[model samples]
Target: MVTNIAKAILSVLLAAVVSGCALGISEIPVAELEKRYASNPPLYIDVDGLQVHYREEGKDNDHTLVMLHGILASLHNWEVWSRELAGRYRVISLDLPGHGLTGPANFEYNTENYIQFINSFASRLGLEKFTLVGNSLGGYFAWNYAIRYPQQVEKLVLIDTAGFPLKKIPFPVRAFTAPLLGEISMHFTPRIASSILLREVYAEPSRISEAMTERYYELQLRPGNRRASQTLFKRNLEILRQEPSGLEQLTMPTLLMWGEQDHWIPADPHLKRWQQALPHAKVVIYPDAGHMPMEEIPVRSARNLHQFLSGAEITDTSE
Candidate 1:
């Protein structure tokens, strides 16, 4: 019943309405995060035009332990350990560039980009040297950073890290890394997506909880986070091709914790490579754990980490 001009105008208005609603809903402020739940307030530092978000807990005199979360994960991933370790150590957890409340990096998201972020973050905090613990992508960054700046890292811990190439990629990874398909697929991620991700990450699916799934979903919806995740996924493929030889050069005391049931990076050959490269490294594989051993077996993992950092009686099985 409407004229062509009226229809065109109506169509434009409708499109704008939808777009506006989408953006408005997606734009979640960093400050509002606390209102939703009890979380450590974010400490911000200016770096390359971006306000980096980090949390520091415990006394300043205790040994510093810097924890890095995996890809698509924020500092909240270390909440359990941060609380447990705060009594004995100065625990610091940061949301890497392009993730969590940190926003996006000014430069490309890659290993070198992360290296700069870590160094900058450390310098800003006046951290001369500290123990580094990283998981998954964080582990890769930790290994790279430690290799380049051995003196800056007192000890290193890698959990289900990605450094070497694999013959077969996991289903989720394969789907996430695909071209146009991946972009389209991200919008369709449901509440079940977190469960699927957790299932793949943990050897025991029973370990996953509704609360964990809810946290992941809530964080993913943070302003600009999903786009940044996509950017990271795309850039990581290029970074993986470089094959940094720094692993063989590491001399610091290292701990490798992995889940025996990790589908992403199988424990067999990858662990062997780490063992061979890091002759001084101690390795522990949790039989019931999956890709994220720390979350799956926090007690045992934390004990091992505490012992390693304290220079207790540790066994290096590879030797």
Candidate 2:
């Protein structure tokens, strides 16, 4: 009887283990992801031994605009903006190392390394001077790149950019930074979690489509992408701890585009900080948008950018 009871207990435990294993999310192969995600055959360039994935449109135009996406975001974030602005100005967008199709490389994922990657990428493409635009973490890189290569950056546009001290990281992102929890959390990325994150970033959660959420979830499962995010998140925390130094010194034409509904990084305080630092910079605040105004309100945001580039007077549209 004792032996039979022991066997029954073991069987129950084994069944529970199998059920847990079935629930775990598997990593999506890069090739399969490329098939589903890549709208075109995707272009890549050799930058610092990394085959950087990039897209260039409106190559014939005189002015070049290089755009970058935020953490866990790919160049696809700029699809609407790229299409809208490409006709007017040459638009180039790329998947920075460890994000999108460009998976993890040997280089350390830090601010300096990211800045160098931007410089090297621009040089490899024979781009001498271009307007640099970035969103979220990409904004951090954009401004830093402009500071390091001020002469090379003709103009700088920061869309809900980072680098200013964050009072608190949004919970979804902060969860991925905890030591043990981060590693475990990476393996169980659910589709709904992606949807939740997308909702958090958009002012109107109702606007988030099924396809958009699916894409984010699929890309997060790209092999090694989660691990890279973990590393990047830790590095970013380090960045937030240090004081931001060179905003006032950036004397080039600067444009600050913010979303009034940005909960991840409140628009009011950050906007105040930026305005104080860049008194002469033009500011455009989208009232009904969230963290990513480019994705949320592409038409209006792009129009503001076009106006700024054309040297037209920007009527304050915050109201």
Candidate 3:
């Protein structure tokens, strides 16, 4: 009887250990992220009765680079590039409604809503014309914005964007996109969930550092971000589904960059579509990189961007 009791205790302990490990896998402590990057206090702009938060770096009235980040991400994603590009071009990175320091939009979170957000952001900043650079969902917004306000856009750069709907989405996104299931899942997500998200953002998982994961986690926990993200996730399909055929309509010099190993939105079909639609647009596929090419291949990505912005001749067009 004593031996049986000991075995039972050991079984209970083993179960607890397994559960703890699962919970700990992605948890990133919020305090650590805040310790690393001091929150650049937000400048609020009243847009459609909601306060929108944004950070403006570099000189105003210069040629501008307006950066839009991906889904579930914040303007902080562009920290590396903003510093590099600020000297040459005024850089404006803002938290999109329903993400980062910015809370949910008073209106819907669709393409039209985002375009309005972009317009409001630019007009408030007094920008006449600017280069637009976006990643993932931002990539979608960049293209959409360029199409709607062609004259306002001087140049376009799409980094691992997600405008065209793929037949299959990444498992995590699919989980989050599901109706009631997504809502239920959000409640149970632990701190380590951020690391899992970071892992998905990169083609090379090893590139995701502890510090980066922590930053992403803290940003997610900021005031209204979690609930807003959940709502955005549920509505993403509707928003992304309405992708306009603006590739042919855009005349601005365009650069399309992608990670060849991207599992989130695979390269072949999307690349092929873009190439066929925008025959004049330049395309570059980074072999070792995954979904987030800017993060995965920042140096090369930055170089390509600089060259493209400088009007250097691009050689790669073959599909």
Candidate number achieving the greatest TM-score relative to the actual structure:
2
> Which regions in candidate 3 have their CA more than 4 angstroms from the true location?
1-42, 239-243, 314-319
Q: Candidates 1 and 2: which is better by TM-score?
A: 2
The per-candidate count of clashes, in order, stands at: 0, 0, 3
Per-residue CA lDDT of candidate 1, range 211-314, in tens?
Answer: 88877766776677777787787777755545558577788889999888887778887888788888889888887788887777776677777878887865
Q: Which is the better candidate, 1 or 3, if ranked by lDDT?
A: 1
Name the TM-score of candidate 1.
0.85
For candidate 1, the 10 contiguous residues with the lowest summed lDDT are 1-10
Error of 3 at 50 (Å): 2.8
> Each prediction's Cα lDDT score?
0.75, 0.84, 0.73
Give the true-structure RMSD of model 3: 7.4
Candidate 3, residues 160-195, lDDT tens digits: the string is: 787777777655566566664455444445445676
TM-score of each: 0.85, 0.91, 0.83
Candidate ordering by lDDT (highest first): 2, 1, 3
Better of 2 and 3 by TM-score: 2
How do these models rank on TM-score, best leading? 2, 1, 3
lDDT score of residue 195 within candidate 2: 67
